[model samples]
Target: MSERVIKPVGRGFLFLDSHPAGCARIVREMSGQVEQRTPERRTALVVGSSSGYGLATTIAGLARYGIDGVGVSFEKAPTARRTATAGWYRTAETAALAAELGRSWTFINADAFADTTKDEVLDLVAEQLGGIDHLIYSVAAPRRVDPRSGETYQSALKAIGGAHTTKSLAFDDGEPVLQEVGIDVATDDEIAQTVKVMGGEDWARWITALQERDLLKPGFNTVALTYIGSELTGPIYRRGSIGAAKADLEQTALTLAKDGVTAWTSVNGAAVTQASSAIPGIGLYVSLLHKVRGLETPVQQSIALWDQLTGEAPLDLDDDGRIRLDRWELTDDVQSAVRAQWESATQDNIAEVADTTWFLSEVRRLYGFDVAGVDYEAETEVDVAWPDH
Candidate 1:
């Protein structure tokens, strides 16, 4: 007899929205990367620790490697009637679990771009944990509102002239259908702004701050996650504005190496993460990675990110100090097979070109709606309070 209206308190904010079981699964998966026999007390700092690859790294540090950690994020909690974002709730839950397991940790809610935020993080790490041995950066944002200038900087993806429409896949439904989307060619200022927010400048700043504070230990190790898809999805992603930012990231990794900082980028195999799903032609790519890895091992198994973080040898890294997991390059043979199919792909050959069953099912699983062993109809709730604005 009543209609409840929901106007969320924070801008684009949510609370208690992560699938607990899935978060656990990912954390457990990452923990397996820690060698069984090694025993050591390690301290870590994970920037962008709330979701996606950043969260995965944090989980690995705690659950798998038995390392205590400090997490820096801007994660907000969910409001009533509005669903919470996955990272917000998962971070809270993960912290709770880690506590029960006797892991020492700290999670900070602060804008990483600000000098004040960076200093605060450094202070926290130094006071509580002594110093950091590992640092992981995994931040991706659409825009950066300059704290000082009060100017809003927005990011764009390069779409060719005119409106571009392509066959988009929706996980809720198993279909590859055409969806009309438009993107603007970036002006010089827009490109600079996007790069500033997403590029290595901020990453370098974070490292500098920690080092200045003497918060970095002698065996300092750091990892930043990056991505590269096959040429088939190049136009919409790899060659787009985001791709440009990633290029900067790759270059930064190389520069960090020159500085004597042990830094490596892990080009992760595609999985449905909050950041990756936002990209244009990524649905099909995620599907393929899942299908191929599923038949063999989970995405976590294929990625040696946790190994790299723990200083384990034999973890593969590209020439420029980044791990290449294009999924296309996994088996070499597997990539060749996909390339052949994609080259001959046409609207008529959509079914043959794309594996509809795998892609569609993975998409649905992204929203926690179609995941096996998950009861989608069951009512779920998570309790987390994002810091006030």
Candidate 2:
């Protein structure tokens, strides 16, 4: 194993390396916060379950609910000289903790959009896990290969109507700055491809495959995590190509429900995630939300979601028939506050106006940096292996 002092290196929200010790520390901490409900054996399946909401939810499912579950994610392993993706290290940490706690948690580092991964996961579920009680689809992929056509599709992060200009946080070359940014509109092909990559077609396939194999448990329920940005980003996000894809995802829930599969879409609150960082205006909005209204960490939000899913209370839904986890972040007063900040905050007063410092820290934490008590100055082991089943 090689060890060296690894400092974070990346422009904007892009992260290059992850720290093993820090990731393991965070995983252990998240596990400590959750109380395992009933030792009764149940199983869960999470697609794209290595980072952001998926990772947080998976940790809660196994640590809190003690469910024997399988987490499906695609993470690049470390090259000879480069470090592995943060998700890779995080998965290893989670599996180790699960084993230590005597819980069955399997981590599959494979292309979830591929048919081969599906076949392998389904076979394991059918033969070993017995049945799946909850399936959480929280995939955030830039591109996907159609299992049938083998054609790769990539999603676009742009407006739909026309070129839209907005003020957002830019933390790359220097201090965090809020500046005007313009995004071009996506073409017809881009819209369709974006939906193909981010929509619920793949999710439907998973459900169909499981049903064909009779792998769904009695009273089984599934949820797909989605987001609807505030009016500040309505054009670039809520009414953009990405929004179109999210709409398709929400509609897929209804189609799945028609098939007798208990499926629903859960609209989650904005948080600092790799995917969110790539979206226009989201970083600035989340940072402003932190300054105005307190922001909820993925771990905290996952706990609340788990409580609702496992609690006796009826699931709260809006008129559109989707769970409203983003309610707190989308309150009338909070949105008004964020709008005022977005319109007025500039490079000189960004720190004074928005919580860019905390937002950047959260982004760095996604890759295991900025974590408390972890000495980034000291040499950390770069060869953290992913735990095998």
Candidate 3:
């Protein structure tokens, strides 16, 4: 081990700008629901379990629901070398905290996209927890490798046909100015590669492997998180390479449902996950939504995601049968409000316009660095190492 080095504390609030008490309340409330709903004997597996939405799902599972869990993540471990990812530290702390409650937890630091990693997870399940009753698929990666050909691939963003221009927010200085981003209208090979990387193949493989290994308990429920953005992100997201991946994911849900699993629907979760943040021109949209409700606190903005997860709101499906998280937020009334505000915004109208600083800050806080209560400067010495690779 390398000698510890002193690092300055991270400044500002971490996570969505919610009061510690309120955020704690939400966790406890959700935990109550989990305890009441899940059977004492049940177990769960959360994919992409190390960070962002995955971390939230794990928190809900362990902290709120009383269900023991196995988390699979492609996370780096803490090191004197500073190689660990943000999720690594958070998950480590979560595991430590969960242990105090006598709740079982396992953190796997292997690539979820790999068949080998899936097999290791199954082996662990058979050896320890027996089987999984609930599976939450929350993995979001920008790149993937084919299990067979060993081909590495990265996804792209492209315009539908011709180049188009749009305005995006600059959270650093809260302004929405017109800009341009383009994609190379994917070639057939490129489309296939995108599907290969972000597609449902890996998910299906995991399910199939667990089923074959007799590791999935009957009545197994699985959820895949996806997004269908508003007209604003259509060119860059909804109609782009990623959209194709999401379509495959949705279809895979129905296929899994047909496999006799009791619930296999994708939740079309809120677009606050790290995956959504990567979508071009999304910061402004988030800021716009925050302004719609006159939201001043981060918890209020974050409550929507939890609402969908636990509140059981009906999923809004588009014409093609995709759940529309973005469109639902962009309802006629909501859009009218956003558009009106957009029209009124000017170079000099920072106050009248949505403040995107909160939006950026919230996403950054999810990494567990910026939140208030946590002391970033203190040497935790607590191992933030990723699970064994």
Q: What TM-score does structure 3 among the candidates reach?
A: 0.79
lDDT tens digits, residues 301-328, model 2? 7777776666534788899889878888
lDDT of 3 by residue, 1-389 (tens): 33233332333222222122222333333333332334265588888876555666676656544668789887655444453455666666667656866788888888898888888889888887899887777777878987777989887665555555555654323233433444456766766677777777888888888889988886576666666656766777767777777778878877766777533434342444456666666666666767775432222222333334343355444554443334446568877777776566554664457756667655655454335565544544434344332
Compared with the true structure, what per-residue lDDT tens digits does model 1 show for residues 1-389?
Answer: 11232221321111124454454444444455544335488898888987767776676667666778788888555555445565665566667757876878888887877888888888888888899898888888877766567777777766533335444544323345534445556666666777777877778888888888888998887877787766656666666667777788878878988998988777876666656666666665555444444432223533356565666647676666677655444567676665665445555655655676665544333333334564445544444454222
Best-fitting candidate, scored by lDDT: 2
| Candidate 2 Cα deviation (angstroms), residue 27 | 1.5
List the candidate numbers ranked by TM-score, top first: 2, 1, 3
Q: Any idea how many clashes model 2 has? A: 1
lDDT of 3 at 280: 61
Query: Candidate 3, 224: how far from true, in Å?
Result: 0.9
Angstrom error of the Cα, residue 252, model 3: value is: 1.3
> Which pairs of residues clash in candidate 2, taking residues 3 or more apart in a chain or in different chains?
36-64
Output the worst ten-in-a-row residue range by lDDT, candidate 1: 6-15
In angstroms, the error of model 2 at 264 is 0.4
For residue 190, what is the lDDT in candidate 1?
Answer: 62
